[model samples]
Target: MPDITTSAVAPTRLRIPRQRGQAPGTSPSGPILREHIDAMIDLHPGGLTWRRTFPGTLDHIPHARHFTRYLLADSDHRHDAELIAGELSANAVRHTASGRPHGTFIVEINRTTTTITIAVYDCGWGGVPRFGRLFGIDAEYGRGLTIVAALADQVGYEGAEEVGHRVWARMVQPSG
Candidate 1:
């Protein structure tokens, strides 16, 4: 594949028209309001942390995956992070308004000495994923979180799509 970075980055912009009264950024419950933000800033932790915003479309998932792969290239959880990144990014593309025109999602990676946390923040246009192990072998979709939970040391959803839905997973190396 051509260098994804150097490749003409035009097709990622959506040409689809927006619907009337339906804003591009919103939670399914309503317009994202304050009081839902679980805002916390890292105080320059000892390792690496990175964040980026990408157009919420299928084409951009690989970019996020690639970035995650590059960032965790040295970690024992590199493969787990990459898979979690791909699954989370694809879920954002498929289940949220982030996939629409003018919609976007943010990818965040926080790596410490023994763990890497991967998160995808999407414009919440759908129901928050629930924990019921909600899947079946015959189903064609909806196993993102299940896979994430299985692979990660911890997993969670924070903030509404109104404030942006944050789905995160962390993978850690076992102590010696």
Candidate 2:
């Protein structure tokens, strides 16, 4: 693949066209916000990026995790990477249009000398992926993103509901 760099790219210059009267970066189905982000200062681009598309379903969550673990088998962050992959995949299926009939989600894993970035691209229509407050013990939901944020050094998302959403988490390690 060609080398992709974000050093010269500006988020303001990248805009997604939406319906008139609708929010600039929103969709009619849900409120997915676009984040203004810069590349992680500690991580460089031009690394090996592995991508896979999985049918959006709860049963496929393990597949996503397994794929991540397989890729990072020799790394110290393998467990964390797999867990992050599973959480993001679960969110895509449970909260986004990706769960609809025939919908699918894409998992992209990027590995640099000192960083591991995992991004999940969903079919959209779900609200912003944010860290939810730890609810009461009886609550069964709302912890996926929280756990992701805790394990990742950097986390954010981009894309509109009309198109799709890419929720990503980056785990950084000190370069030798």
Q: Residues 1-176, candidate 2, lDDT per residue (tens digit)?
A: 99955454222332234777997656555422222122332244566789999999999999999899987765668899999999999999999999999989999999876688999999998877876566778878888898999999999999998898999999995432
**Whose TM-score is greatest here?**
2
**RMSD to the hidden true structure, all candidates:** 16.3, 17.2
Least well predicted 10-residue stretch by lDDT in candidate 1? 32-41
Model 2, which residues run further than 4 Å from truth? 1-45, 132-134, 174-176
Measured by TM-score, how close is model 1 to the native structure? 0.70
Pick the lDDT winner.
Answer: 2
Error of 1 at 92 (Å): 1.1
- Whole-model lDDT, candidate 1? 0.74
- Native-to-model Cα distance after best TM-score fit, residue 58 in candidate 2, in Å: 1.2
TM-scores, each model vs. reference: 0.70, 0.72
